[model samples]
Target chain A: NAGVTQTPKFRILKIGQSMTLQCAQDMNHNYMYWYRQDPGMGLKLIYYSVGAGITDKGEVPNGYNVSRSTTEDFPLRLELAAPSQTSVYFCASRGTGGADTQYFGPGTRLTVL
Target chain B: DQQVKQNSPSLSVQEGRISILNCDYTNSMFDYFLWYKKYPAEGPTFLISISSIKDKNEDGRFTVFLNKSAKHLSLHIVPSQPGDSAVYFCAGGKDTGRRALTFGSGTRLQVQP
Candidate 1:
């Protein structure tokens, strides 16, 4: 089964342009997150949603925004993209119970020039 | 300051050898810790984990050990194989309200045959 999926696997944006990274999960998980991984760096949390309509910022949320209109989908919007936003974006979801192992998407690679 | 740190940026090991990746956290409130493995062009996936209440946790060929007093944790891979080569990340978070996992710069592990 396709556990988690992301759209626009690769993207190139010019400065001041905008785009959205789409994510969807079929696990019916209640918690989902958006993270960006820079070269040689760990994944930094950008934003997260506990469930539909509930979202919050995390470690690095300056150049991005997120929305969770439904449990299966979360989209990260890059408004006025900058070179600093060029990185790999990942979406993850996990059950609220059990070992809380997060399942991640294939990731979207964005390059802002 | 980086809350989580992995001093070693990369590690190389011979096949069938043991590979140990270290992680240290400065946050005292972290109740749960996890390890994730990532390959190129993909998102990180769950590997193993340990809770503050438990000193060690094991799953098949991987083991996670936690030292609460020192705020240190480690992932040990026994009999490392070429297929296990990848970037390894350690993440932890407190259950203050949400499970916000803070990640460390990953350690790239390469197993040579």
Candidate 2:
């Protein structure tokens, strides 16, 4: 079902450059999330959405933004990339009704120069 | 401020032995715990999960145990195989379904033959 798919598996951005990381799921999940994993650290939540048009900030939402225009899509936007933002980004989704586990997409490795 | 932590960065086990991975969480609000396994360059796949209401849940060769009072949980892989070699991540989540999960720094497990 293409559980979750992300675009541009790898990207390199310069300081101050902007980009949007795309995430889509064909599973028809009601919940979608964006997370970043830095070396030697756990995955940190950046943003999430419960449904289309409903998005909220997560633990590390400072340098990112997100929008859930449709149930199938949730995109994360980086306004100004920085070295600290260089990390492996992942997209995940989950269905409702007591499903506690999430399905993850192959991560996008970003490097900011 | 790390809500979840995996004390061990890596562990090596002989094939056909048991592999025990531990995780601890600081947040008392976490009502569910999950374990995921990831291969290099691939996304994480759910292994097992235990709810706060229950202390243990078993799935085939994998089992998850939860200790609510201590805020600790663990995943056990019995008769581990070389194919089980991967990074294991433990995550905590609330039952609300609206909140994103807090993940632990993954433990790289190497099941050597």
Query: Compared with the true structure, what per-residue lDDT tens digits does model 2 show for residues A11-98?
Result: 9999999999999999999999999989878888899999999998888899899999899999999999999999999999998867
Model 2's TM-score against the true structure: 0.97
Residue pairs of candidate 2 with colliding backbone atoms: none
* C-alpha lDDT of residue B40 in model 1: 93
Candidate 1: tens digits of C-alpha lDDT, residues A25-77? 99999899999999989889999999999999998999889999999999999
Highest DockQ: which candidate?
Answer: 2
Chain B TM for prediction 1: 0.96
RMSD of each: 1.1, 1.1
lDDT (CA) for every model shown? Answer: 0.91, 0.91
Per-model TM-score, in order, reads 0.97, 0.97
Q: Positional deviation of A76 in candidate 1, in angstroms?
A: 0.7
Model 2 agreement with the true structure over B1-113: per-residue lDDT tens digits = 98899999999999999999999999988878889899988888998888878999999999999988898898999989999999999998887857578899999999999
